[model samples]
Target chain A: MSDLVNVSYLAVGPEILLTLGAVLVLMIDVFRQPSARVHAWIVAATILAATVVTWFQWDRVTGEGPFLAFSDMVVIDEYGVIASFILLLVGALGLAVAWGMVERLGRRGAEGIVLVFMAIAGFQFMAVSANLVMMFMGLEIASISLYVLAGITRERPEADEAALKYFLLGSFASAVFIYGVALAFAGTGGVSVYDIGAFLRGSVLLKPGVLLIGMALLITGLAFKLSAAPFHVWAPDTYQGSPAGIVGFMAAGAKVGAFAGLGRIVITAFPLYEAEWAVGLAILATISIATGTLLAIAQSDIRRLLAYSGVAHAGFILTGLTAGEAGMPAVWFYLAVYTVQLIGAFAVVAAVAGPTAAGSPMSDYEGLSRRSPFLAAVLALFMLAMSGVPLTAGFVGKFGAFAVAWRADFEWLVIVALVASVAGFFFYLRVIVLMYMREPAVAEAPGTMRARLEPVGALRWVLIISTAITLAFGIYPTPLLDLLSTALPF
Target chain B: MTELVLFFIFGALALVGGLTVVAARNPVHSAMGLMLTLFSLAVFYVVQAAHFVAAVQVIVYAGAVMTLFLFVIMLIGVDKAENLSETIRLQRPLVVLVGLTVVVVGVFVAVGGRFAWITGVVGAGPEVNGTAEAIGDDLFTTWLLPFEATSLLLIIASAGALALAFFRPRRREGKEEGAP
Candidate 1:
């Protein structure tokens, strides 16, 4: 028993380190009165340390094959390790991209950094949690931090609106999720994911009405977090109004964590009901792809356009999920490559619009190529990658997802996804066209001409790294695909 | 016989309290209605032999939470009555339609096939008692991780409240001149 307890502590070492780092940063800010640069360094170092710990955990788990700790409340497996790595990567790059905003916020920067740490830790917990209630707790931790992060610039009315809307809708979804947990517990007499699966496999339930309803509600709650269509009303407003610098992290992190949780629940706990949930996911995918593509074309703001595009991406990822356990590798691959592109694109937005600014009007991108060729070139690459043009990471991701979904007898979903992918190029290419072909809208007033948008400091590094990864993986995706093939939930 | 009588009385009280919460115009009155409902829920927990849970429901909900709610109401001033007027067009009709749909669904779920709401095997898992000892043992042992993780939630809540409510940025000259 003592050995087990000790092992449990070791298993959760990364999470503990993150939590400690958050508190430590807060304490240092209070006592030392350090600059925002110091806080950023602390956060970066903490993320680096956590990644190292996760790497060690991956080594152990791969050797032993998915170790459960804390009385099976958490499963330390390749799936969780990979998810944690993605989240940590997002956190590091996100902090770098948002560094200017943090410095501008002055004393409030420490709180923002702390919230990021806590949010990342929370999402990591969500990825690893084995109990339904534990997952709920993780979701709340990440969500509350994000809600505050969205409104960190409280003086901006748009920020306030975004925060309030996100809070209200997010709380409603949390309530629905917990209610589903209760109903599932009542229906299965179990709260542990593995135990629920065991119960379903052992006993034939004649009246699965309550359980089915619970499952639907759970899916709905997660879908809202993933920003799938129909539940994606909050995405456009939140993304458009949030400070530009960190929006990438917020969007990418939530998808990674939510998909991890959703994949685990559907594939591990409720695989017996695949036919039922697969159809539900298929419907959500169809709606998301259609709505995201159509609405994205209509958006005048760059941020809102990205939000709608994220919805479409969620549908594409869900297409992979419809293939059940067989498609998890495709889903992970898509998530990794796509998130890098997302962060990279938003980094350009941060440079164009000040990091603390609320909106990124599409007009700002006109004549970007003439101003700063570097920013325009990278942004174009990201846009092309998002559109799934040939020889891009996005193409590989979409292709992988489509192939698996087709084999799973979801050929129709694949067909719809293919159509949506083609339609998606319209909006994505529009940004590139506006950047390169069109002249600056304010060229009439030489005095009002905006300064050259240069990627400097940490933002430059973020762009370079993301661009390298995007292209590298686009050319040769075997290494990542091979790694993800081992990242299966036990 | 006494248990049945107690159940019926509290059940009715809970129903009435829930209705009054929605119906009452005064915010204070609605709070009182919510308290009554909470108290009735505590009674239900006790009736199920979940003594610890009942005690917590009373102390946490009926006692502490009610006091906080009343304090907030007092701070906001009770003279302001809640506006019951509908602002959006067709709002009332849409609400009624949704309410009717929910009622129909509830009825169908209750009366469809099996009358028993809980269809799981009753004694498949460990026998649970309502004692603090049993709950504490499980909480400290099997549920220790989640229990510890709850501290993170509390920290986030408090920190988030602080960051949102306080933490104003100092205005720099020429930068924030045009805003607000």
Candidate 2:
């Protein structure tokens, strides 16, 4: 009873580093109001340091079983480490993509940077935590930050409404989730994933009603975060209402964390009940893909369109999950590529629409090719990638996910997904055609030009890196696949 | 026997309080009913010998959270009774069906022996289970990560609240004009 547990802070190195950076930014904002550029540098340095730390952990940390630390609340594993590295990249690119907005907001923008750091830290925790309560806390930390980020621009009534709706719905989801956690704890007599898994493995209950209900509730809550159907009502509104500069970050970061957490729970803790969960997940995937793609066609707002598309993408990721533990690498690869493309697409949005404004009509993008050829071309590339065009990362990702689902005997779901993807091509290509082929529709105003494009600085770097990666991975996916094959979250 | 009687009384009060919360016309009345439910729940904890939980429940839920709710209700000026209109089509009937299903399921679970596994494993433990020291030990050991993570969550909440609600950025101040 008196035995001391060996605690290692190194297990949470990335999280600790990012937290310190968040604190430092907040303090700097208070004491000596730094410019957004200075804060960007700080954020960049912190992300680089965190990445280095993750790389070090990748090499240093190895064992037959997961090296659990902090009284067995967290594990230092390659799966989490690789995910952390990808999350850091997402954070870095997200910062670059939103730099214009930061500069626009000037002194107040430091909080956005801090919030981003906090969100990344929370997401890192979500990936690494082994305890249910700890995961919930991480979810809350990330979510609260997102709710505020959604309403960062209070001047816009839409932003206010988006924030309020998100808060209300998100809090409801959290309540449902915590209730499920309590049930799981009561049923299994444990809150840690390891303990719960051991308990379930040790016995066979004829009527495991509580655990089943817990799993269902848990899936519902995470589905809401992932923006799956029936639980995705708030997504389009929130995405359209939030500042254009950071919506991609918010969406991508949340998805990464949710997928990691979901993979952890489904693969590691609840494998015994695969038959039960896979059916539910398949249903969710079908509805999400069908509803998301069908509704995306009717949307004129680019942000809302992207929101629906994100829902469809969520369905594709869930297809990967249907393969159980065997599907984790595919999910990881898909998330890594998709999130980069998501941020890049939104960077273009931020450039076209002012960083903080809402109400960007699709018509605004007409003749985007002539006005700013670089932005138009890159945006088209991202759109093509998202549509799963050949020789793009999205194609490989969708193929991997669909193949895994097929191998898992979700043949009907694969057929549905294929049809949805083909239907998805129309809207994605519409953006491309509108940008290149159509002439810029002249505005009614006398002196005003039809469109105004901002001078993109750091965003260009984000676009270049994302586009390069998307094309590189599409043409030769073996390297990334090889790397991801080893990073399985066993 | 006295403890059992006290338990029944508090449990009855809690159920009635919950019904009042749903049935009350005025929002303020509903809030009052919520306080009653919370207070009764604290009493239930007390009966279970979870003195710390009982105290915290009273302090946090009945005292602070209830006060905050009342203040928000007063501020929003929604304390007046609503018309109880059915806005969405089929919403009332759907809610009724769902509510009935939930009630039926709850009754079945409570009466069924599905939860026997819990009691069989835990046994009828002694009063030491709910003591402050026992909770403290667990919090410092097994639950330490969640406890500390809570601070980070609070920080995010505060920072987000401030950033969203208060921080006002001057628009295009001290910048060159007509650049783009």
Candidate 3:
């Protein structure tokens, strides 16, 4: 029993720090002066500590069997470690980037910081979930937090509308997810995955009555999370309505948690139904690739454009899901690439501000090549990386993703991939031409243009780090691949 | 037997209340409909043996989320005239979208999601601790990293929400109201 207690403490120690820190930050902000900006740095430090702790566990880790502690509900494994680490790092980046971005807004409400911590914790819950109940709880935590974040601007009806839509859809999807879990429970008479797995090998549901219905519901829930085609209607509006920094974090960090969590669910629970679900995933991949790229071409709003681009990126990630046994590691590596590149793009976009100036506009980027070549060049690097240009992380990530599809004998998907990649290049390059070739909307005070257009110190560093990592991984992706390969037992 | 009864009752309430929320003419009435739907959902949680979730559903959702909705409705000052949509985009047909989505999800399943391995994961177990304690153990132990890491996301959500609330970037001019 003492041994069990030790194991539990060892695993959850990082979460304890985070939860306590988040609650404390909120309480302190309430009692102390509202203007106290103490929690940003403190939150940053606490997350950093948690990351260090997670890392320490990584080093001292001895392989152990995945267990269902607490009456057999959840499992702990290397996959959880890898996914959680990414979440921590990204969440910390969210705070770090927001430090400047929020200050730029000049409304110092620490509760906003507190809410983000809660959302991150909620997403982490999804990543580690085993039972449907846990999954539902985590989904609510993430979704509700997102709805509030989406509509926080009371004056903007568009923001309000976006929140309402996201909320309504989220609740609807939650219901669908729960109903699926219920159907699964009906088939198995038990709520545990282990019990379900045992029953599925040859159960009454296996005869194709109730069990089949249950599986479809489960996949639907996961699809909404992945933002794969058909279920992806909410992506553009939600991202466009959200604040730029939040959209960026949601794009990268949220996907990392959701995809990893969903991947675990698919692989662990539904391997027997691969033939049935795999085809659906394949169709989603094709449509997601084609539709995501084509629709992005029609967009004028920059945020909306990125949001659509995310849809296409999700398609590429879905290819990993369809690659069957061989593509799992690629899924992991590709997600990491997608996260970094997105953060870099949004960071550069966010950094386009002056002391008293309004938010960044596309027109502000006109002729940026002449004003500050560095910013232009940074944006260019991120765009190029997104386009899967050689020597950038996007290339290797795409290659890794498609290679899995190839291994699955879906070579046509590769052709579709090539077509999508070629098609995607135009939109990404449009940004380049706009910055370098087009002229700024208005001439700036000579040095003012340069100073104003400069990147935030922290965000600039973040972008630089992300850029370096993208390049490094592009040039040498084996390290990431090796890490992902070792992180899961598949 | 009691569990089944509770499930049936909540399921009936949820179905009827959900329908009412969608069909009601008055926005406040719709909000009330939403409340009933939420309450039914709480009862559903109880039937599932998720006592903690049921409590949260009542407190956080039915109590807090519903109250927040009521407050928003009041602040917006909805009346008979305002409840009506002025544009063609928000006509009655939009109601069908929800039913359509459910059907689509159903079709995906009815067709077996077109994969064999996805036949469905079913299990048999000696269930214990229901939902709360089991989840508590699971979350605190093996799943601790992901659970803790979720805080970072909450931080992002909070910052984003706050920025939206305070920044008030003008959609057209990029400046706030009355600001030079």
Candidate 4:
């Protein structure tokens, strides 16, 4: 309960910037009749500004004593900065891909952009949160906005269904997470991660029963968010049913936030009991990988296929967690690379289908190469990256995750992941095959059903940038690895 | 002796209220049972010297949150009868097994020294614990960031509600705007 308030202001500059940006966008949307493009530019500028603020915090974050603010409810650290930076990048890319959605929604598009900023701010808060209650608040903020965003196309019944399902399941998960925090508080008489860690370390309990249950519950709630199997039933439906434009942001931002929070909980709070939680996490990871790979093979819709792919990727990320403190950098790297590829793939999906549309069947992508070579090539590239092909970001990500897990003595889990990686090629390659090998269908009416690419200038930029990053990281990942090496949770 | 008697009476009331919630046929009756359970829980909190929590339980949970639940139920057509039959064949047996296991585990832990630590006060027992003044001081100082963040969370929620529920989508032109 320090008396200094100004330090807290400096610590939370990025979040403040995002919150003000969100408010400003909403205000402008209400007062001014600006084009959707204007709103997009404003959103992009806000994200860039937040990024700059995050950059300035880097020096302060990595400084001696690792600056904390608001009675240690928030911390400025390399871990939070890197995670927040990725989340903001994801937001910017998601907004770019959502350009068609903005134009399509017209006046109502500002609401979408506002929700995006709110979601990003929420996730950024999760990354920096020092207190358990603050973490829960951040999770709720992000998840609530995502649920509403999932149902943004109110005209579509599928969107309504997606929003309702996500809201119901997501609220239940949040309650479980908060209940775990309450139990942890009761067990240790502490709420902040630092306090809890000190308490756990100082105590020698004959029975550490309640705390273990709390940790298990905490992991379960985050596992649900990560879309790990056994709690992954909501993902495919939500991803397939929600509007195509913002699904990438929803999926990627949630992973970055949840992983950041979960990593903090496990590494910061539960290191003493690593043997117990790592075994449990390993089992969950194996299940998610196996289930995601096997089920993705049978998917008809491309969105559902990607949903399962996301599930497998979640398993890959959790493998990094099994390495305890040592695996964090790999976790960050994998999330950064995979999320960009995910958003890029979805950007292509939005380009082929209208942004607001939900379902995009596999047949819709047939002969995409002839229709638009650029879009088809980008989709294929992302698919190759997603499949962990050599000389792609996904390959390096998979290698880093597996290498860390193996070093942590989770060899059997690594073996399972290796098998799953081979299985992943089937579905990802199927999309590529549909795009390249198949022929475009003839229209019944003169030329009504012809394959014509949308004039999505923003999506093209997103594709180009994501593709370049994917390739660059794949070839020379030393810089990203170096940057992530310093991102240690305090 | 009087304290023990009060505990028994309130405890029995809470158990009955919980049973009523599960046994009631009507949704409104179930809601009433839930309120009874909540009120008895508030009494428990008060007995533990958590007066602030007790007041918040009554005001926020029983008063405001329950009202919202009832409003949603009414708005969504509470007149519609719900199916009481089990959808899954093994649901009843599974519920019974889980309930028995929970009760057994609860009794086991309660008989042990686990619950003893819960109320083991080092210095003060009841006077300063969970008082409004103590909570308010902590909220304003120790939890200042979370408090402000909570205000921002509320803003996001209200905005989400406005976007999702209030704003109506405009109809498009003749072009159905199918797959691009």
Judged by TM-score, which candidate is best? 1
Quote each prediction's TM-score: 0.94, 0.93, 0.81, 0.92
Q: TM-score of candidate 1 restricted to chain B?
A: 0.83
lDDT per residue (tens digit) for residues B30-116 in model 4: 788889889998998888778999999999999998998888877888678889999889999999998999788767766764443
| Residues A434-461, model 3: lDDT tens digits | 8999877776666655434666567778
Better of 1 and 4 by lDDT: 1
List DockQ for all candidates: 0.50, 0.38, 0.19, 0.39
Candidate 1 lDDT over residue span B1-180, tens digit each: 877898999999999999999888888899999999999999989887889999999999999999999999999999975677888999989989999997888678767953344766575455559999977877788788889988888778766776777755444443578655
A26-95: candidate 2 lDDT, tens digit per residue: 8998898877767877888899989999887888755444587788778778788878888899989888
Evaluated with lDDT, which candidate comes out highest?
1
The predicted structure with the larger TM-score, 1 or 2, is 1
Report lDDT (Cα) of residue A447, candidate 3.
68
Candidate 1 lDDT, tens digit per residue, A1-490?
5444434666787889889888988899889999776787788788888988998998888887888888888999999999999999988898899888888877777777888888898889999988899999889889989999999888788988998988899888889888889878888888889999999998878778788888888999989899998999999999988888879889998999899999999888898999999999999999999999999999999999999999999999999999899999999999999999999999999999988899999999999998889999999999999999877888899999999999999988999999989999999999999999999877644445466668889999999999998898889888988999988888
Ranking by DockQ: 1, 4, 2, 3
Candidate ordering by lDDT (highest first) = 1, 4, 2, 3
| CAPRI rating of model 3 | incorrect
Q: Candidate 2: where is the Cα deviation over 4 Å?
A: A1-5, A62-65, A443-455, B1-12, B76-87, B101-122, B125-128, B167-180
Residue B147 accuracy (lDDT) in model 2: 82
lDDT per residue as tens, model 2, B1-180: 978898899889888889899898878889998998999999888887788899899999999999999999899897455678877899989999999998888668657755433511456545456777888988887777778778777768767766776754334432445343
After superposition, candidate 3 runs with Cα above 4 Å error: A1-7, A31-40, A60-68, A105-109, A152-162, A202-204, A353-361, A446-452, B1-16, B27-79, B83-180
Regions more than 4 Å wrong, model 1: A1-7, A444-449, B1-16, B81-88, B109-116, B123-127, B169-180
